[model samples]
Target: MEQEANKKRKIIHIDMDAFYASVEQRDHPEYRGKPVIVGGSPNSRGVVATASYEARKFGVRSAMSSRRAVQLCPDGIFVYPRFDVYKDVSRHIREIFSRYTDLIEPLSLDEAYLDVSVDKQGIGSAIEIARLIKQAIKDELRLTASAGVSINKFVAKIASDMNKPDGLTFIGPSQITGFMEQLPVEKFHGVGKVTAEKMKKMGLHTGADLKRLSENEIKQYFGKPGAFYYRIVRGIDEREVQPHRETKSAGAEDTFPVDLTEIETLNKELERIGALVATRLKRHNLKGRTITLKIKYSDFKQITRNQSLPFATDDLEVIVKTAQQLLAAVDHEEKAIRLLGISLSNFGEVIAIHGNSTQLSLFD
Candidate 1:
């Protein structure tokens, strides 16, 4: 039953292999094939953001303390992150991806999904497009990427990682069942630490074992996420290759030097943030349907109030007024506020009220 549906799905997941570490090697030819670490200094309270495979062989991993990594690989070259350069590289890569398909969903600065059903390069076969994209990235940016070609996002994502550094793996329709049978349940998306442990206890350690449980049984064990596990294990995924959506909400946050006990001081700060938000709205030509006020206390507890207006408005006065009213309705009581932030959103839809202000979305 499921085999028929698997034949119809086409999805591609692209990931930059050791993105940050590889970038460091690309710029400096001397670092190629040598251990390279990109993150904080070993002296400071720094963490290892990424390490090259050479460094990995020495047991250096991301989020590991630089001190520990240094102890593991005494010769590892540590370098700070160049986010600006990485962002430029990201833009160049995305530009290459856009040439292939509009159904590009960027996962991060260096990874994305390209649905090549209607490829712009006019290559009907997705595998061909994947080859072209990898060549383009290598030729243009001098970087390596791994791609997973399959019938759905889950399988495609895992397939991409099958080969490391510069890799291209395809999971054809014919390979679906056997692939799932061998796939570890812990590796199934959304089944992380806690779920994996629970699944092991439930005698469901592999996708094949998961396939034995009914949807209701799975849901009974895993609650909300179990249904997803059941469907994905059967080679079923209905998700589209979502495009790079726009930033729906805009807001700013600030932490106070001292907690505020008085309402006037808090309101004053809110007024400033509101004015800033109003100017931003005018700049972007966007109106928000929901005005949200977020407040944090000294005790580390926080709360937010969201008031939905009849229609979205870009008016500064409206945003400020609504924010103030919402703040009043919350539990300010005698509690002191340590942090505050203001946000506005219409779920990515920018309501353009005036003609002069040209509104644009990130998708554009």
Candidate 2:
């Protein structure tokens, strides 16, 4: 019965095209069709939040440095992000989604996944539901959106990105295998650049190549995530569309422009990151008992250390001091640090009560 229910699940992934840049273009007629880059100034240490399609042609991308974006597209127009306006637009689109289904899980301000298996409008066809949602956004919001329809979230997400600015793609179960088999390994979800390169070196350039490996072989090569790849490559993803998902961890990390070898500079960076985490925890009215410090060397080697506190806290001092302690225990003098991160986890509500005790450990 559970298997039957899973077979009937209908999912849709909706993604706005160049959300920030599109909004800018829509609001100002002069910016339309021009290369608009929304982020901090090129002279500053800011990253590109979003780039218009015109700018994308010049190789500008999100998370890329604003200075690099300018170097790529010298004619690009840079504008500071107006998050207030973007949030308003996000709310409006979510309202539009509510008319069709209440089981909507927003990934960010620009994208979301909707389970339309049991839509409020009594719509039985998932494809039709997606079409209606996209058309509604076009009519009411005067903005275009791309959508993907499938039996599960993974396929739906990949399908949505198949076509560009305004696209609606539906992948039935029968079509899933062929679609996935031909897909480049790098295009698979969770396969980062490093993982993709590893796959290629192992002669697993595409899903078809990955399918040749047994589950045990994949597990031997990739660890726990290999189990996930094993299933997804065979068109099997049992994960559900969770609408009210709670964040299990809150943290911040920064990739420094230059590698730092000194402990003092590293501590200052950790302090800044710890404070950011504390502020987020307070804003969410949540306290965490575990503090984790993550470090990545210039050579891309990474390590994490975690410590559990006697009491849940959102205190900046506690977070900073705890992270600093964790940092002190690690042997950082051997390698220059390229990135540092601090995260608070094991939230108050979910953490196991240990009779008020603190535990500290080093994790490799």
Candidate 3:
């Protein structure tokens, strides 16, 4: 019974190397080990979505303007993204993951987490399983991937990124604190740009420095996020790996390919944004009680217009209609439009059981 209870829980994070470009190179044998860029067309005011290591050496990167990428490396090969093909490959990967455990939570097509505490294969060791998974991808897909094995998702994610392109790393529970001590504050999960800057300003540059501060002290300055920071600094995270629900608020905003001064262009852009919000809500089966319209002007100034609703419904029509009204209320003259977005929040889960509440609105 002691041995049964002592069975170590294992989790692995797998990240496909330069996923889009790698997929492209796989389908075309001639492109192997060569620089490849996958995204929109350069002629269509496109940007590089993913660049293989070869293209990366040439200064190509994701979200960089294709025009600039071409200037950076004229010899770089550019190919459009094939989402269908990527999805098919992803399906193959998920099949392999299912052989491990059902507690798989996919972050994206290229990354996912596997919980092996109750693995189907009875592979008692997580590291060995991770190594085998990596090998399987190489053999079956003719592609290289990397993995990180740890007890938790956050550290597992960090480990996977420690080494790239067919690399693997592990962090045992006893080594967690030391692993964090060497970790830079910027590398902490959930600590993004704004927080990193504040930490630096406070002279808290590394996990070791952050560990020196008490939770209360950090909370005194950063409020709720400060509390989160304190826990992560000490290499203590209570959050569990959740499955079946991609729990969190989500929204999409796009910076225009170019600035638009015309009201016609602006109106069209708003409609495009409205359509996007509708699609996401439909996919998540979540209805939100709040709608936010974010705008950025050519001068770099930004504004957000928000509306709260009496009820939450995952109805695209409702969100789109609210977004349209919000757009009509904004001032779009004099300055050109740089970006537009629509966000829906005050999210609540959808329950098919009639015993459950419909249009839940606890936050509202």
Best by lDDT: 2
Model 3 collision count? 0
Candidates in descending TM-score order: 2, 3, 1
Worst 10 residues of 1 by lDDT: 355-364
For each candidate, C-alpha RMSD in Å? 9.9, 7.7, 8.6
Tens digits of per-residue lDDT, candidate 2, 8-65, equal 9999999999988999999999999999998757875456778999999999997676
lDDT of 3 at 245: 45
Per-prediction TM-score to the true structure, in the order listed: 0.68, 0.79, 0.73
State in Å the error of residue 99, model 1. 1.8
* lDDT string, candidate 3, 174-290, tens digits: 788798987988998878765788889999889888888888888887779888777666656544555674646657677876887876677666655554554344334456789
Candidate 1 colliding pairs: none
Clashes per candidate (backbone, < 3 Å)? 0, 0, 0
Q: Model 2, stretches more than 4 Å misplaced?
A: 1-5, 250-291, 296-302, 305-329, 333-364
Better TM-score candidate (1, 2): 2
lDDT of 2 at 284: 42
Q: Write the per-residue lDDT of candidate 1 for residues 140-190, one digit (tens) a residue.
A: 999989999988888899999889879999989889889988898878877
